[model samples]
Target chain A: MPAAVDVGELVERARRGQPRAIARLLSLVEDGHPQLREIAAALTPHTGHARVIGLTGPPGVGKSTSTSMLVSALRRAGRRVGVLAVDPSSPFSGGALLGDRIRMTEHAVDAGVFIRSMATRGHLGGLSVATPQALRVLDGAGFDDVLIETVGVGQSEIDIVRLADTTVLLLAPGMGDGVQAAKAGVLEVADVFVVNKADRDGADATVRELRQAVAFGHREAGGPPWRQPIVRTVASRGEGAGDVLRALDEHAEWLADSGESRRRRAARAVGEIEAIALHRLRGELAGVGGGRLTELAERVVDRAVDPFTAADELLTNLHTT
Target chain B: MPAAVDVGELVERARRGQPRAIARLLSLVEDGHPQLREIAAALTPHTGHARVIGLTGPPGVGKSTSTSMLVSALRRAGRRVGVLAVDPSSPFSGGALLGDRIRMTEHAVDAGVFIRSMATRGHLGGLSVATPQALRVLDGAGFDDVLIETVGVGQSEIDIVRLADTTVLLLAPGMGDGVQAAKAGVLEVADVFVVNKADRDGADATVRELRQAVAFGHREAGGPPWRQPIVRTVASRGEGAGDVLRALDEHAEWLADSGESRRRRAARAVGEIEAIALHRLRGELAGVGGGRLTELAERVVDRAVDPFTAADELLTNLHTT
Candidate 1:
């Protein structure tokens, strides 16, 4: 595809809000192509401004409905939005899954919204590397808001959630991870908690439990001063998405007042810089990296040296060569 | 603590099979102390010989009992054993959780059996970096077998499982992730599938479903020729642990003949080398690292330059300095 398609032209079109151009750019990111560095350099100047929101929770808690509701609400507010619905659990990837497309059909021709689902299928540095780069693409392409929705099951989900400026955790009445996910320390990253399926049987119980958990968490807290708000929603009927949006606005205000917005972005940038640099360094030090890896690996098996010393030797060679 | 004790002498004691010394050595690794490189250098020669077993699955599936069962079985065969029960699911680490301590009380008096639980509490590099080093400590200390047990909820567990030569995935009758976990592609990492709580009503059904999944998985497979064996165990009563032990020996023998063991260890070494080199390189490039981070981060945020260019400049400074 690169033999014919000019990456520079793609970037130009993507910046002008061409959905196909933006999709191609994301495909390149997901593919972990050799041209990624060039793409990133071209896209950088226009980035660093999108309001990244992370929406995550365990499986089957109406994440898609809530995401769609938020999308509709954001569109009504007249903001250009981009969503990367990522399923890190699946080891395979081709492109946007049918489920993602179906849930998002209403906005297919809106021109104000863009949605993409990332599959890990042979992603070079895994989702951690691909996600930040994709976020860059969306942020650069003139989107005012970017939403990252994940199936919130693993450490990768945790890492992706931290990339956002604000996180909203969704729960249903009888899901497995009501307080369980919070206990795993994901609660610290959540700015708002939504008990979706609020019209269901145990909605009140779920909300009450979540409120108690939130209060208990803050009782001995030492980090931020903003108390998290728990909102009840029946996203299928679009009941309380407005309240969720209002909560996001209020939280954004708190972030600015506390100087946490600047701190979060700075920390996020450092993390991105660190991941990219380490990935590139790994490449340069490993025959260019792979072939050299074989020789070094053989030597270690032969007890010629340990991994630490071999890594030192690899670094030494890098410094000299 | 370092000024009060000699690392060299401690290494000597640990290598002599002193449990306290081994515990202290692991503490240093868990703390990501500055002495890790020296410790690795010292432990390298005596390492490379222990059989590593990874035991993992979802929570409440009797991992502790299985680990304890395996410990007794290995000791009965006259092999010194080590167990590192890692809880990556927990954000707080205060050493061994009381539940972990309680589960293995039977082996507490056996000098030949050692068990430790890892909490993530401020682990400098996380379990991925710490597990291999901790494995080295046990292996170098003359333990013939080292077992890594994890709650198996996330990506961290998958990484830890790969560090071992053989991985045993335990599943109960009606746990959250039965075939669902298999679908997420943890099926490939598994060498033996143990359906614990075999006396439960759904045991036969789970085994039958797992067999079908395994057969389906291998239909188009091109890697190792080993068909994964499914073993059923009521771990709480120590009923089927012997069968699991026999399965381990069979797998070990197969690994010896298949050359997969050599390849797996070499790959493991390559990963460890990559991690260490990146850690050291990131340190050098970032200003001794953190202070340099703040200045570069500000520039990226101010749009003075993008993160890619900033990372490149950081690398350039690293080479020149």
Candidate 2:
């Protein structure tokens, strides 16, 4: 079993603006140890305090650089911020190289900013299994704004929307046909789409294609009725970062005024609860004693009875006996 | 509520070469109505009788044409076959076009061949929520062989390996770099790799690259030693379909000899059972007595206690009262 961390103590330290404590807590959660439940329980009150904005797109879309710029922009507005950068797991080894933090070293010593790198840790999604819990920790720790940067590999990119109140999708020009961006699963989930590397020649056409795609109705109920705004950003120079942050602020305001924020929060709560319940049940099922369950499984497989009826019978027997 | 069909009777009719019954059963399963469980429960015993082969790759790689050719080839071998073609769900409409079936209409009336087109039905991975259950129905109906043709949408393609006893990953010549294949999450899961459209330029290089990728891995004990062979095929012309089938047979034989077949089947059963359990639990939790659970969720969200303890306490209260 992984060593247990004192989640309360970690949260208190993070609340007091201790970067090391915050980083360590984020790492523990990202590793997805079973003990994450204890930490999440301790951190729940701290969520809903920070505005979480998620940055996601295809790999090599300059997500990390864009995130750094966004963080810088938030800091310039005198708001203390937190950054969580998520990387993909290597299929061969199930390990992740958290290389995004290298670009954010400028904030390492800044008292106003905190940056942490995270891995998916066997989770199929781009977001870490414990990401929502970790976000709760950061939120409880009194960060005014939190930025999550995700390595968008495929369907997993969809998970980021659940974790963030606002989602920005980054697209680079000259990468592929502009249509590929529309074909990729990210188009439907993004609230604000950015064409990064606008200095490239095809940027205008990519922006046009993205506008058309967004014009095709994709937003869920309670979001802005208009299409998602397509902005051009040269993130390396920190250009257009402020506009992105302002857009996020406007989205947050809209969510608050339109009562969509509560609906999203409720949906997220239900999703999180369901996920936790499933995880716990898996653990319990794995721990059931002996070859008994296996025998039952074999009997079911042999068609003595169906799995549903057999499962109910097993549970009933366990309860009654 | 959708009307529930008599799936067992449907299966019996389908086995006697009734096309409409087979289509109806497939439609019932695809919609994920409550009746799917009943149909699957009745059909479970009849599965494990068919040799299941999965074909997957990126879109525009001729997967549908390849599937058509494979169905033709299997018929020539005098084997009764069933093809389940999976299509992508439209992000905008949450429905599937199911276009692949149009290509395979020539076999519609062939008694020895049964063809069905399935949509992803909002499943993130290439496989449908009811895919395994549907496969069981076809298998139980006494089809000598079953072919699952996946949507070839990158990561979801990996889900096919779990359901299939033998998996073939197809590639087209001059397709993006071999690294893109690895990044697409296909290289690691394929049992046999095929370079379709072999008449196209760069077929040899694609094959060589795939061979190199396969050679880089040294096999471990439990999993099949990844000796994925790269077969060059003009699938539209049926030039190498026979060779593909022979390779599939050899792999099947290897799996049986090494006891991996039993292990794979066991893993699949456990996976299916887990999915079913979670699905049922979600339904139960949703209907668990109104505002009481909502109150508990709010308290849990407020950090009053850990979710595990909260869940336990709730269950304990329910039992005692």
lDDT (CA) for every model shown? Answer: 0.77, 0.66
Q: lDDT by residue for model 2 over B41-98, one digit each (tens)? A: 7777666788988887654467777888888888888888998765332211122233
lDDT (Cα, tens digit) per residue for candidate 1, span B270-307: 87777777777876866555676678888887777777
Best by lDDT: 1
Best candidate (score: DockQ)? 1
The sequence of per-residue lDDT tens digits that candidate 2 reaches over residues A1-321 is: 877777788878987989888777776766665666677766775667788887776544566678778878888899999877653422111222336335677777789887665543345222424667667778877899988776443344466555788778888776542234224465666778888988889899888877777777466675456357888999999889878877888888887877776666665655565556556554555555125456666665566666556556444433353
**What is the C-alpha lDDT profile of model 1 across A268-300, one tens digit per residue?**
888888877777787787645566666787787
- Clash-forming residue pairs, model 1: A286-A289, A287-A292
**Angstrom error at residue A136, model 2:** 2.0
Please state the error at residue A36 of candidate 1 in Å: 3.0
* Clash pairs detected, candidate 2: A46-A140, B126-B156
DockQ of each candidate's interface versus the true one? 0.37, 0.24
